[model samples]
Target: MRYSPVLDRLAGLGGAKWELHVRARERIAAGEDVVDLTIGNPDVPAPADLVEAAVAAMRAGRTQYSDGRGEHNLRESLAARYAARLGRPVHPNQVLCFPGTQTALYAVLMGIAEPGCEILVGDPMYATYEGVIAASGARVVPVPLRAENGFRLSAQDLAERIGPRTRAILLNTPHNPTGAVLTAGDIDAIGRLAVEHDLWIISDEVYEELVFDGVTFVSPLARTGFADRVVVVASISKSHAAPGFRSGWCVGSREFADRLLALSETMLFGNQPFIADMTAQAVSRPSEAARGMRARFAARARYLADLLTQQTALGVHRPEAGMFALVDVRSSGLSDRDFALGLLDAGVAVMPGSAFGETLGGWVRVALTVDDDRFRTASGRMVAHSLSLSGQRAEA
Candidate 1:
């Protein structure tokens, strides 16, 4: 059966990663151990208090339908927590809760970007962004984020890409696939451009707390002029390892929040009361668990970068934050797909750079969301194979 071209456009986007992950699962099922790193799921446990809160909520019969936006208490808790984290006060009405950040992002696009409206997005962004834009019948104009520039877009680059149909710009910090955090200056420039062009800003800061080496995260909304047009989407998934709960929120002005909340209501009927309860508890406490999570990711990131660099053929973009590395494997004399598949065949798993976009074809995204020993083992094999490939090329 034939499918829509839009469906076809997404055909190979994420299938390969899971295809490899599933193959790894099969091997383990058959007693052949494999180390999988393709998925960016947190391997850590959620805070004990938060888990207890969810259990308590379940016992207290909070498993029913929640308000379309969220529970009043949860929304209020979110506003206070975010305001403290952001160093700015946010009214409770401005907080709109959803199942997760994915829903929040999709709802924002559906509510804001009209058909044929252009969204300026990063080339090697999370693939779902493309899917969301396509589902909305909007076009995504990918701006180049060169590794030479640490995978960041300059204000000039942003300015050059703006056009008549452009509706908004999607920004991800401690970026996925590369983990390149945008500097405060870069964010200021983006805000200035947003103000100058009267465009909307959709900032994804899910990895805000995962920054390392004194890297501070500043949101576009932190700027004065762009506040009205900015929509900040965040989740408790990475921060608290509660992805299963599907707890996330979109923070901004009341009008934007209301519009998105209404869209979310139509999309999901209502948020889960129990999940809201758990997330509310998480937001209220702001525990040491967040710090523990970041430290683990940072250590793994340092280990992987150091190990990969030992092999002259394997080049890794040092992860300033988050749990991933964009390792250049073209130097290993293999296409991204082949390199990923080869790793899978050798009892390892990883995501090909092409999954993000064509411009990143020479790389593979290494996820550090696994046990340290397993990650180290996989990295060693990859590096050894990469060096062998380089040696062969040199001999030729």
Candidate 2:
């Protein structure tokens, strides 16, 4: 048997970031005292009501397969929430629930992009997007977004990149490594381009509720006249700190929703009924609980920012929103990978920016997943290591 060349290519682009995390986890299990800052899995606890809801749901025997689109109740509930949040009225049929945002994103690519198509992605983007696009055999066009520009996506820049073969644009706002939110103006510009180019837009607003410092997250699809061509992939993973639940949803026009449903049937079969029930509860009461979790991430981001500023070797543009901070160690002698490995040897774990892509080699990523006390300790350790590396480089 032979595998596709695209799958082979994706396989070669190993998930080094996750591999390092597993190694770090093993070290911790072996009593090595590793401070993990690799993965962005939120450390915050899920809401008490959510937990109780899941327990009740399981007890009520709702653990079987659900509607491939979603359990109707949960789909309607999430649709209603999105309608209220985006201030755009939508019907329940416009939504499709998936196991998580990853599945939803993959399904979007499968449903929309053709084998020879292209997707415009931020250069230093979330790594999973690369593999997802590759698996679809679509060319993943790199759109370079720099930290100097606050990781903002420029319309003129993207305008030059989109072409006839381009089928869709993947917008991960409140972005992964940088936590940069797309402003209303940015969304409006992208909306205009999407309309003109006749391109489908996949808006990954998973971190929509995690904004900080008064930064608002604007979705590209939230604008008028783009809803028909837009598919929203969102989850309770980051916002509710319930990644383990594996519950997420996609929303679009009824046509797209049906296409996603057919894709889900051939791909996923359906979502877990128990998880859907729990998420329904979470989406319905998504006010105070969501706010409190965002506040915790904000506090962590501030603490890490202050610590990074002390080490002149590391330039930190504290994310305006989201859970990860992209700390630039370009001034230090070591490349991003060596610096991360150096920290690992120091019993601290961090993600090298190269995991995002080659263009991001000058930075290291730190997750604010740990609690405050641990975050302070990790930040201190990182600063010390950065200064030590700087001194060694100067001496050389």
Candidate 3:
């Protein structure tokens, strides 16, 4: 039996990176005492009113197929929200709803790039990014997001990577694995480069609402001149604590949306109308959950960073926003996988940096979504594991 070449391109791309997280879940399900900090599955629930909205829609028979462009009201709601962020008028026709940001990204990538083309993306990106570009038959050219620069993608390095085949530059703000938010000035520069090179800018702003105090998120779309060249993919999953709902959308120029409408319809005509109804409310209002989450995540990140640095050689590359914290374990004299496996044995589970990118070797990512108590315990265990790796802690 033969399969699509895409199978090879996407082979072992997603779940493989999450293998340790999966193992942690299985062990916990079997009654193990592990403190799982592997994935950023939010600990909060969707806003109560949003849930009721979905129920009301379902009872109203919104279960039928929706237009490929998404529910009109939902698209209007998203447009209004993005209008404030982008500082411009946005039309409903420019928004295409999807099951989630992952799907939206895939559709956008397919619409913009294809075989023999390339997408310049940041290293240490979210795990599925490579697969998404590969699925579009586009090569991923990784630009280093160095720690010294706070993991913000460098526009100069990006300019160096540009070639005839470079079709686009992808941006993820409040970035995954490393929660560095790109500054406004940098976004403007990058947007200028995209304009100069005549390339697309795919901005993933799912964490737009997750940014912490004192840190602002700047989108290329917000930089003014590059509106037509920039497309944004975001979801209510992280912001509204509604991951299970799987509701998201793509925002771009009306022409870009028109060109992708055929693909959106062919792939999945539209997201569930009930889900759109729920997401409409989510997009229209400020997310109380996201505000609380930002405060909690910021405090928890500080707590864990202080704990690791004071007690062990491990130091955290403190995040300005997002649900996860990155711990640099280079002092432990072990690879990221070794450090993560050791933490699992010490009754804590986390993601190795290798899962994200090779540039992150010897680092591990820990989710800040766990409750304070469990997170504290996980912090303690991680410290002990670090000490054990340094031969400073005796095995019990």
Against the true structure, candidate 1 reaches a TM-score of 0.93
Predicted candidate 3 versus true structure: per-residue lDDT over 1-396, tens digit per residue: 999999998887788888899989899999999988988888788889999999999999999989888999899999999898777899999999999999999999999999989999999899999999999999999998898899889899899999999999999997998999999888988988999999999999999999999988888887668889999999999999999899999999999999999999999998899999899988888899999999999999999988888888787999988999999988877789988887898899999998999889889999999899999888888777777677754442
Model 3: number of backbone collisions: 0
Model 1 lDDT at residue 329: 86
Model 2 TM-score on a 0 to 1 scale: 0.95
Off by over 4 Å in 1: 1-18, 394-396
Model 1 residue 359 CA deviation in Å: 2.4
lDDT of 2 by residue, 161-250 (tens): 999899988998988888888888888888889889999889999988878857877776677678789999999988887888888888
RMSD of each: 2.3, 1.7, 1.6
Write the candidate numbers in order of decreasing lDDT.
3, 2, 1
Query: Using Cα atoms with residue i matched to residue i, what is each candidate's TM-score against the true structure?
Result: 0.93, 0.95, 0.97
Lowest lDDT block of 10, candidate 2: 285-294
Clashing pairs in 2: none
RMSD of 2: 1.7
lDDT of each: 0.82, 0.83, 0.91
lDDT of 1 by residue, 1-396 (tens): 887766764565555545666777788788876787877788887778788888888899998877877888888898888788777888888988887889889888888898788999987889688878877778899988898999987778878999999999999987897888899899888888988889999999888878886787788877766788999998998888877778888888888887777687888766778778888777887556667767877888778778888656578887778878778887777898888887777777788888887778989888888888888888787876676666778899
Better of 1 and 3 by TM-score: 3
